[model samples]
Target chain A: MEKIKVKNVFKIFGPNPQKIIPLIEKGKSKEEILKETGHGVGVNNANFAVEQGEIFVVMGLSGSGKSTLIRCLNRLIEPTAGEILIDGENIVGCDKDTLLQIRRKKMAMVFQNFALFPHYTVGENVAYGLEVQGEDLETRHKKAYEALELVGLKGYEESYPDQLSGGMQQRVGLARALATDPDILLMDEAFSALDPLIRKEMQDELLVLQARMQKTIIFITHDLDEALKLGDRIAIMKDGVIVQIGTPEEILTHPADDYVRDFVQDVNRVKVLTASAIMKKPDAVVSRKDGNKVAIRKMQEAGISSIFVTDKERHIRGIITIDDAMALLKKGEHSFESIINTEVPTTSPDTSIVDLLPIAVDTKYPIVVVDDDKKMLGIIVRVSVLSGILGEEE
Target chain B: MDKLQIGIYFEALIEWLTNNLEPVFEGLRTGILALIEGFEAFLLFIPSYVLIAILVVLAWKIAGKSIAIFTAVGLLLIDLMWLWPQTMQTLSLVLTSTVIALLMGIPLGIWMSQHDVVDNVTRPILDFMQTMPAFVYLIPAVIFFDLGEVPGAVATVIFAMPPVVRLTNLGIRQVPEDVIEAARSYGATRKQMLIRVQLPLAMSTILAGVNQTIMLALSMVVISAMIGAGGLGEEVLRGVTQMEIGKGFEGGIAVVILAMVLDRITQSLGNTGKTK
Candidate 1:
């Protein structure tokens, strides 16, 4: 079951929001509605489901109501219309007490501004959520320390928010959210305020945390790169409406609209496209079952000078060049090990094409793509690397 | 202009309240009288030397060495002038008025910060409270409680309460928007949000308002004396009416000394939670 499902939620901001819903339903543009009734559309007919343990990112520029949409999930800003179900409980129609309970027990949020209470010490700030839930001082402190240590800030317990650098303050914000041991996290542009290098470090740390925690997260951001890097799936929003929802590769390769296409166009595909994304099925690979004779014949048939050699289990053993195979045959060497070149470059399937460039450039053989156990997955040639950089058509 | 009769209607309103609300006025009068007496007794019970020493140490800790020395010297000068008792009385009155003002003002300010309608309704009233001549409050105060310290305190509270309310409201409202949103997102109930987030954050501003209230309360000391409230104001009034220039100047100096000490101490308190 989905952890959170938002179905046709609408958020209109102004006096008499309910009165303006009919106009939105009639398909009026945001500006037209504003001109007609002076109600600004915050989120227009948003619909999406977040699976448990998934990092579902909602991405848009400022004024796109991505913030509004995330707030709606927790009902920080009440939805003008529609149902939001969290673990099968509809948050939109929940009572105030239940909503508060849900927020206290089920979800926590991290803010873009690192909104640590200025007056609170780092320890106090981190423990604030637990404190709000009426936990005792001992449990709150213990949990707060644990959360701070998780974010690499265990020693900053007594420091004030103003005393810490921006990155450290942001960690305190993250720690505060994590102290409650919530099931879901709503991060609204949570890293947008940091310096670029620190932001990257924080992103990596979050990934590490997510690997351990496996908490479902709804991350909001305007930066496509951040969305692509962190999101399991991304929802692109424009003018308070979701334009498209897809994986990073799908968004890059098959954008649902011109806006999304234009958005993905400037992205550095080399950094985002992985080896598995562009690697091709090896046509002339030889296994131990196939002797040296068959290996040379397969290479010739495929019009290749070299072929990868694998064991019966399809784990990569080595590669053999056409010249080496012929030389071995002439020497009466029946052993495939004698003909195999063990100097073949290999990379994990998850390695980005950018990382593969140096290996692809230096190696004479196509770089072999392998899984964790050295199982041969495919081959990434120089042309495929170039094509991946250009955003693979296949 | 001849037919407005604003004065006549105001007179009728006061008369009606004075007659119909006798028990209410009596209750307020007794309550205020008890509070004033409690503070007065507390202040007077402390030996002049002991009080001065405590204030000096407080100043040193809060404001710095210079303010501490000034406190010691200035307070000693009040004692030297034989104005210690009068100074204590004025201090007690200012303390009582400030305590009462803050008691009502802080919650009102919190309430005002929460709702736009309350903010709007209270804004003009606060403006009127702040801008109306300090002497004007004395009339209602006198009518309600008769001539004594209670009326003087009532007038002083009215005169000094606005700054606390206004600044408290401003302080809470000035708390960062993202911070408030962060509190809300964490499932802070309305009360929790106010206590844990808003109040602590606004404390500095509210302390500043308290400082303003104390200053305004001290400013009203001599005016309150006109309605028979005793203290340094009585001495100043006596000196002035009897043409004793030196005595009046001495009383004025004592009031200034007391004001400076209170101001410096409270000002430092306001600067505590902030970097400043």
Candidate 2:
């Protein structure tokens, strides 16, 4: 089921919002409508549905209404018209009590400026959402502590927001949102305020958290690279309208318009694309139990000079070239251990292609992609990594 | 051209209020009189030296050592000038006015911050309260409370209340938009948002308003003494009418000392909240 679906959502700022919404519906441009009525159109007919456990990013430059659109999802900026459905329930026409309940029980948000309450300590800030929901003090504290640990801020609970660095403060912001255990997280340019290195760190941390939690998230960002990196599916907005919505690869490969094309054109794909996106299936592999003759037969059948060696569980041990297999056969060796090269280049599937480049340069063997258990998932050869950087599909 | 009968209309309005709201005025008079008496009695109950010691210690703790030393030396000079009782009275009056002003003004300020209509409606009224001569309200105050500390307090509260309201409203309004949005998105109820987020964040600014309110209240001491409200103001008034320059200077010096001590203490409080 779609976790949150926004349909025909319009947010007009200033007096007479209802009147201005009609003008928006009539296809009047934001600038023209603002000039005519002195009313700013914040979000014009924003329509999208975010699936459960998906990171649905809204990407646009400043004033493109991405922030406004995210705010409308939680009703921080009230939508002037149309329906917002959360888990198939229409939230647009819900009364104040119902809306408050929805916000309390269903959604929590993180902000761009790391809006950790300056007056509050990190733990207190994290506990704020639960406190507002009237949770008991003990539970609030426990949950807040757990959330701090989740965001890698276990010891900084008593520290004030301003005392921490900007990145640490944003971790507190993320922790606060996570403390609520809400079904959806609305991140409105949550990392845009951090320095570039910290921003990248935070993005990686968020992806790791999402992998574990599987919370539906609607992230907003102005940086195209950030969107491409974080978004499972990105909605590119322009002038309060969503110009395009697609996966990162799809957006990179086929931008819908000149605006989106311009955005993707400048993005450094080597840094944005990961190994997993371009990794090829292993043609042949010999288990630890396999004999030297079997390894040679498999490599010959696949027409490859080398093949990966794995245990019965598919945990990668090393690589064995045709010459090593031939040596093993000539020496009457039965075990593959003596000939297996344990110094094969390896990378996690999620490592960016840019990070893989140096390793890719020195290694003649394909880089082995593995999971946390060191179980081989796939292989990224030099050509695949190179083609991946060129925005080509293997 | 005939001049507008502003005075006549004002008199008639006061008369109408006095006639219709006599019981209400009487209750308020008793209430305000009790409040002032309570603070006055509390101040008087402590011996002069002990009270000074407490204040100096408070100054030391809150405002730092320099202000504390200044408070000790300055307060000793007031006692040396034999204005201890009168100084205490003025302090009590300032305290009473400040507390009352904050009580009424903060909620009104919060209301103004929440609603644009209330802000618009109260803004002009606040400006009038702030800018109009203090003497203008003193007459109605005296008529309503019948000439005593009550009337003085009423006038002082009216004169001093605007800054608290204005600053409270400004402080809450100035709370970063993103912070308020964060609170809302986290599902804080209106009251929770005010108490947990808005009020706590705006505290330093509101305390600044309180500082301004206290200063205004202290300024009204001499003016309030024109009525039967006795304080350092009475000494200054005596010095003025009887041509006792030394007494007036002594009274003025006491007031200045009191003002400095209070200012430093409150200013420090606001400053502490501002830092992380």
Candidate 3:
């Protein structure tokens, strides 16, 4: 189930995006609209939905409206034109009271810099969101301590923000956000301020937290690797619009446009794609049925290209010599898990034909395609991966 | 104590000794008297009382060149007025009160910070202490200690202690949250944190409070002298009573000089923490 949805989010940073809407509709450039009206667009027609208990990342360079988009989801910053649907209800016109209720109870945000109040102890900072929402001292303390315990800061309850290191302070920030037990976690580059080592640790900690808590998270970042490592589905954004929204594997192997392709070009799809694409057919079709050379000749001759251990018959079985399969076995195994060693060559159906061709060209194996049931559907030759790159659709 | 000025309090200790308590009280009494006598000796040891420039230069070095020049000119004018000796008496009394105020104020401030009860209980008292008229303190000092440098100095100390206490407390409290948390995470106890992190960070503000205390003490010269303080205050008193215009002018000028010099020196000391 989708937990939250952002539809046609346009947060313009001036008097009116309404006036500019007609120009945009007419396919006029943003430069032309701004030249006429003198207003800038922050986020332009962004649309995406996040599933419950998923880490849906929004990635862009700074000023690409990634932060603004995330902020709009929680209404921390208002969107000029959008409908935010949390659990299938529109929150576009939510009143102050309703917005406060949603913010306090459903979502909590963690900032880039650890926004722990300087005067507060770690425990107090963690408990503050609860306190702001009107929880009493004992209840809030218990909840805050529980959240701290979850983050492995159990004994640090009495320590002030200054007493902690940058990492520890961010942990307090995370714990504070968690204390409210919000249904959605909106983290705005929360660990970017930390050193590289600390950022890695916090990232891993967030993964573990997500695994345990299973809350819907909208993680925003400029780091592509962080997005890949954390996001269940990434929405790669550029110039305020989403270029694509897909799983990390999908983004890497099947990018939607030149922008997304360039963005994921550095990714190693050989490692990311599974083993269903490069497998051979299970029912080997032998052309000649008698002599030893005839069997090898038949295996070579058949365009179905089967090294058959069996036949298409009622419990039909055939004998296989070691030499008959050895030449073909060196090519690759076509399996779903890709749990085999890197020494093996295999590809998944999800692997882009363009990305899979080089390995195929070297090894001379068929590009295997499998169904959801792990049944081998067919095999694509090395030329198909190359052909797809050339815009020849089959 | 060296017993150079240890009075009968030292001798009668053994006679009244019911326990170790007698010696403790006697020891404290002797220590205090020794400090006073040491100060007295210090004031008199100067040859020609020409150490004033050292203070003047120090004030400039610490506070700035302006304070230094002001101090030098003020002292020169007082000497020209022929009130140098009387100025020394007034300086001694003001210094005595300031030392006592610091000795008492800082610990009370620290104590107040440590205990919520003490801070809450004493807040109103300190408010009253600061807001009340200066003469209200003098009446009690005169009634209990008799009119002299002792009562006058004691009264000045009481009158000036509140600001030192308040500033010290505020400064320590205002030390950044991160600094305190850093200390705590390092396993610093409450006392250790207070002494190490809080006190050092709060030093500038505390010194500012001390500077204010010193200035307040200096301003009390005529007030203290009116209650029998033996310094430039007495010179001014003489000027007023005898209707001697020459004496009054000399006394008033001497006072302005003393105030400027002390103000500059303490202010310099307070500001030294800044450039560093």
Q: What are the per-model DockQ values? A: 0.45, 0.54, 0.02
Candidate 1 vs candidate 3, DockQ winner: 1
TM-score per model over all chains: 0.81, 0.80, 0.45
Counting clashing residue pairs in each candidate, in order, gives: 0, 0, 7
Residues A1-394 of candidate 2: C-alpha lDDT, one tens digit per residue: 7888888888889889999876776788989988999999888888889999999999998999998888888888778998999999998878999999999889999888887788888899999999999999999999999999999999998898888999999899999999989989989899989855578779889999999999999999998778878999999999989999999989989999999998887665467678766677789999988888999999999999999998888899999999978988898987777888999999987899989989999999999999899988788889888888787756
Rate residue A24 of model 3 by lDDT.
Answer: 63
- Give lDDT tens digits, candidate 2, residues B238-273: 999999999898899899999999999999999998
Model 2 chain A: worst 10 consecutive residues (lDDT sum): A268-277
Candidate 2 differs from the real structure by a C-alpha RMSD in angstroms, to one decimal, of: 11.5
Candidates ranked by TM-score: 1, 2, 3
What tens-digit string does per-residue lDDT give for candidate 3 at B19-132? 445555455445544555567667657743366667776776777888778777777777676776677777787777888899999999988877889889888888887677
Residue by residue across A271-371, what tens digits does model 1's lDDT show?
76677667777877888778788988998999999988888888998888899889889988776786677888999977988898889889888898888
Question: Which residues of candidate 2, in runs, are more than 4 Å off?
Answer: A20-26, A267-394
Model 3 misplacement above 4 A: A29-37, A269-394, B1-276
Write the residue-wise lDDT of candidate 3 on A155-259 in tens digits: 999887878899988898889889888989888898789855467679889999899999999999998778988999999888777889999889988999998
